[model samples]
Every structure is written in structure tokens, then in C-alpha cells.
Target: MLRLESVYLRLKNGSEEVPILENINLDLEDNKFYALTGPNGGGKTSLAKVIMGIYKNDEGRIYLDGKDITDFSITERAKAGISYAFQNPPRFKGLKIKDLLKISADENSLRAILRSVGLCPQDYLDRECDSGLSGGEMKRIELASVLARPSRLVIYDEPEAGVDLWSFENLLQLIRNYHKRGNVTSVVITHHERVLSLADEIILLVDGKIADRGSRDKILPLIQEDARCCWKANCGGNNDEVECY
Candidate 1:
């Protein structure tokens, strides 16, 4: 349902321009789950931002449902049924959860949205979204706000970041359920093995370009091999020595 045509992006680091995404052309089908994963600085998040219109592409165009949206504003993209959940959810010191949901989505679906995130409406509806809440709570709150209105496509930038194990599992279930819905597309920017397993296709971005994209069998082994060398404490075959990052 989404397409990118010769997409290119570069950013200025002081005086030099560094390429973030180079000639990215992708076609994401409707109702499919695609995971974007790769090494640090591989431009996964940059590509997502370009799709969401958070960053303008240096060249080329982005189209959603056959319409060119390369120039759409972030708000305009949201209005057109696209949602992007940030890696670090923002805090609103004085905003209550109920008020945040009401402003972000259809007012009638507040309770349903909370429940969709596995939160009890009665317990969290009155709670403030401030430092008092835990990181997991904040993440879920942000997700709920983005999902307040029904979206044709949702891009989650590293949903597992900053969440505890318990919250991470819950987030996975939430995403799984969302993907089960018909005719909606999901793109997740993540490095977690569990998240990678959930994707219909795994896309490995390397050095600002797509290195490979295929089924789990074709891609997982490659990444696992790289992870074993880089992530393992002593680069040993022992399972206990592996430190997941």
C-alpha cells in the first residue's frame, strides 16, 4: 500500500553531508508485517521518518495508496491514516491519560484503546503521563495515542527500547494483534530477535541501502552469525556467553 521511488536522504554533521538513505525504493504490500533491522547507523529510522514526513527526502518521492505524499506534513500524514510511534515517548507533565487519548483519537474509543494496550482503563485513565509513570507505561501511552485513530499503516521505531521484559512481551502481543487485522500494513524498526521472527519479511539495511530482504530462513542466519561475532562476550559458541544487544 506504500511505495518509495528512488528515495535519497542525507544529513549535515557540522560541515560534511553524510548519506542516511540512498536510492531507497520499496513497495510495502497491504496487511503485511515487515521488519527493518541492521547495524547501528544503517538508516532504518531515517527511512521511516522520511515515510512519515518527519524528515524531507533529499530526492525522489513517497507514495501511499498510489498518491504522492513526499511533500505531506507530519500532521497531514497522520490525517491520511499513517501513525508513527517514537522510540522514546514524550512526557506531558500535566496531561492525564484520558485527555491525551481524547485529543489524539476518536473520543469514543478511549477505553478500547487502553485495553488494546493491555492496560486497565479504570486504573490508568486518571493517571498523569509524567515522570511518575514508568518507561513501559509511557511507551504504551504513546502507542495508544498514535493508534487512537484507525490507521492504514503504522511504523514503530524500536518499540522494545527502554521497556522492561514484562512490558516488552506485552508490546509484542499488542503488535501481533494489530497485524492480525485485515488490510493494514506494519513496518517495525527493531533489532530484537523475537521481533524479527514476527515479520513476514526481514529487511536488512546496510550502509544506507538495502543489503537484503527475504524470508526469515534466508535472512535470520546471516544476522545471527553477525550477532554471534559482535554480540557474544568472548565470541564463543557457548549460549551463556552471548549477550543480546
Candidate 2:
């Protein structure tokens, strides 16, 4: 289980302290899938980073299975069974795909891990993990690495971004399979309705605060209603832009 108690974060914006997250509290149980969604710049990603120790929280505490990890560094957090998949996965210029997979899991498991993400091990194993690979390819490789490692908590940030519709569907199915296994707690930060619908619970963040949180059946309708209003017409009085509330 994971818990956050009165967590808060602030950033220096040209010498002024700006609050990014405010008085946040959450409890995530094991073997459950969660979706965190909100408008862009609402601090959803920031909160994820804070939990992973990419950014330190200014106040409150973070606990993973009853241990306080608020002051833990990024490496320390990973060692404690926390894994994060970035929205834009980084490219390792000289690393081979097979080599990276070997680092996460044994050689015997490499082929199966790649196959889980719908990639042919023979086709990609020798490719360089650099710009030569497409965005979708990189995304799949990153996700495969996450699956290779044994983690208690796994956070995926915008997993569908920049992928084709077919690849996106494949990714969704992979995540669904992972959730079904119930080996790790999953948190997916996404705006895709299909992904949101699969979650056991949905958390809506807005303006650095949780606007709503409940089961998928409870919160999805409200989000759909809000999306309809935003896209149907310029409800916010601007002719060119749709306001996502």
C-alpha cells in the first residue's frame, strides 16, 4: 500500500515561491489499478514525480508499505520497489535494445518481455536505443523494461502519447493483462477514455488539487459531461480554443 499525508510542493519561479501541489492526501491499495487524469498543467505529473522522488516535496510525508520515504532520492525510491515510466522516454544513444533488457531481466526473459509488448525480439534486439527508433517503439521498449523489473508500485505517465491508434490499443491490452495478474499496484496518468474506463478508480486533479475521486462508474460520467461542454462549442467565450475544466 502507498499513502500520502498532507503532501505539498512549491517551486521557485524567478525568485518567487509558487505552489504546485497543495495539501494532497491519498491512499492507494495493493493489486489495484488507478487512473489520474486532469487538464494539462494541473500538476498531475508533478505529483507523480514527487512520489518517485524526482522532485522533493516541501511538506508532509510519503509512505510506502508503512515506511516514510519523503526524503529518499530517486535511486533510493527505485530500490524500494517504485518504478516510473516517463511520458517521453529518454534515448540512450549507444545502448542496444537487448542490452537494456538484459539489465532489467535475465537473458532468458528478454524475448518474452519484448513479445509481451507486441514486439519481435529478433527484429528489435540488435537496434540501438536512440533516435533511430520511432516514438512508439521507444515507448514499448520502456514499458517492457518496467514489466521486466519486480516492483511494488508502477506509475506510467501518458503511455498513449504519440502512438498510433493500433499501437495504443496494443499498449492498453498489455496494461490490462498486467493489471489482471495483480502482481503490482498500477497508476496510469492518461486522458484517453478507454484507459480511464479500465481503471478501478479515477482521480481528477485540477489546479494542483484533487477535484474529484471515485470509482470509474462514478467519476467518468462527470468527466464525459465536462468534455462535451468543452468541445461542443466555445463555452468559455473564446472562439478559437476549447477550455478543458
Candidate 3:
């Protein structure tokens, strides 16, 4: 299980302090998928980064399986069964796809890893991680690496960002397969409704806070309504308070 208690991150904007995340509390049960959705600049990415230990929380604690990981470094968090995939994956100049997958899995061969992400071993295994690969190809390769890594909690930041429609569906099915095979906890950060529907639970973040948290059926309508009203529903004017998104 994963638990975040009153987690907060503060940063400087000009001279004033801005809250990237407010007093947030979340509990994620084991062997489930949670999808986080929100508008741009709503702090969804920041929260994901904080959970991965890329950014330290100014206040609050993070616990995985009841152990405090707030003081842990990024490597420590990875060692503790947390894996994160970035929205914009970095390019490795001379590394072949097979080499990257092998390193990610800490093993000899990565044929299964490549296959899991719908890549053909004979075709892509030797390709370099460079500009020669298209954007969708890079996204799939990064996803293959994420699947290769054996981690209890896997966080995918915009897995559907650059991929084509066919590949996107393939990726989604692969994630479902992963859930069935390993029963590993997964967190997906996406803006699309189709991606949101794939989650076991949907968390809507607004203004650096969890505005709504529930099953997809319960939250999707609210999100649509929120979008229609320009994020102001029932309430009269623009209020800073973050309600169910």
C-alpha cells in the first residue's frame, strides 16, 4: 500500500512563495491502477515527481508499506520498488534499444520486454536510442524499459502523449496485462478520458490539490461538468478553493 499524508511542496515564484501541492492526503491500495487527470499547470506532474523522489516535499511524509520514505533519495526510492517514466524521455546517444532494456531489467536478454510493449525484437532490439527513432517509437521503447524494471509501484507520466492511436491502444492493453500478471500497483498520469477510463480509480487534481477522488463513474461526469462551467459549478464566482473536478 502507498500513503501520502499532508504532503506539501512550496516553491518561489518571483518574491512570493507558491504552493505546488497543498495539504494533500491520499491512500492507494495494493495491486491497483490509479489515474491522475487535470489541466495543464494544475500540479499533477509535480505531485508525480514528488512521489518519485525527484522533488522533495517541504512538509509531510510518504510511506510505502508503512515505512517512511520521505528522507529517501531518488535511487533509494527506486530500490524500494518505485519506478517512474517521464513524459519526455531522455535520449541515450549510443545505447541500443536492447542494451537499454537489458540494463533496465538488470538481465541478459530483453526479448520478452520488447514483446510486452508490442515491439519486435529482431527489428528494434538493435536500434539506437536517437533521433532516428520516431516520437512514438521512443515512447514505446521507454514504456518497454518501464515494464522491464521490476517495481512494486510504477508511475507512468503521460504514457499516451506521443504515440499513434493504434500504438496507444496496444499500450493500454499491455498495461492491463501487466496488472493481471504481476499485480503491481500502477499510477498513470493522463488527460484523455479513454485513458482515465482504464484506471481502477480516478484522481482529479486542481490547483495543486486533489479536487476529486473516486471510481471512474463517479468522477468523469463531474470532470465534464467542471470543464463545461470553466471549473465553476454550483458556486457562483471563481473561488480559489479546489472542489471535486
The best candidate by TM-score is 2
Spell out the clash pairs found in candidate 3. Answer: none
lDDT of 3 by residue, 46-114 (tens): 988999999899999999999999999999999999988888888998999878888677555588777
Candidate 2 per-residue lDDT, tens place, 84-161, comes to: 988888999999999988977899999899998889999999999999999989999999998788888999999998
**Model 1 — TM-score against the truth?**
0.86
Which residue segments of model 2 deviate by more than 4 Å?
Answer: 231-245
What Cα-based lDDT does every candidate model obtain? Answer: 0.87, 0.90, 0.86
Model 1 Cα displacement at 89 (Å)? 1.7
RMSD for each of the candidates: 5.3, 3.2, 4.1
| Residue pair clashes in candidate 2 | none
Off by over 4 Å in 3: 12-17, 106-108, 231-245
lDDT of 2 at 38: 91
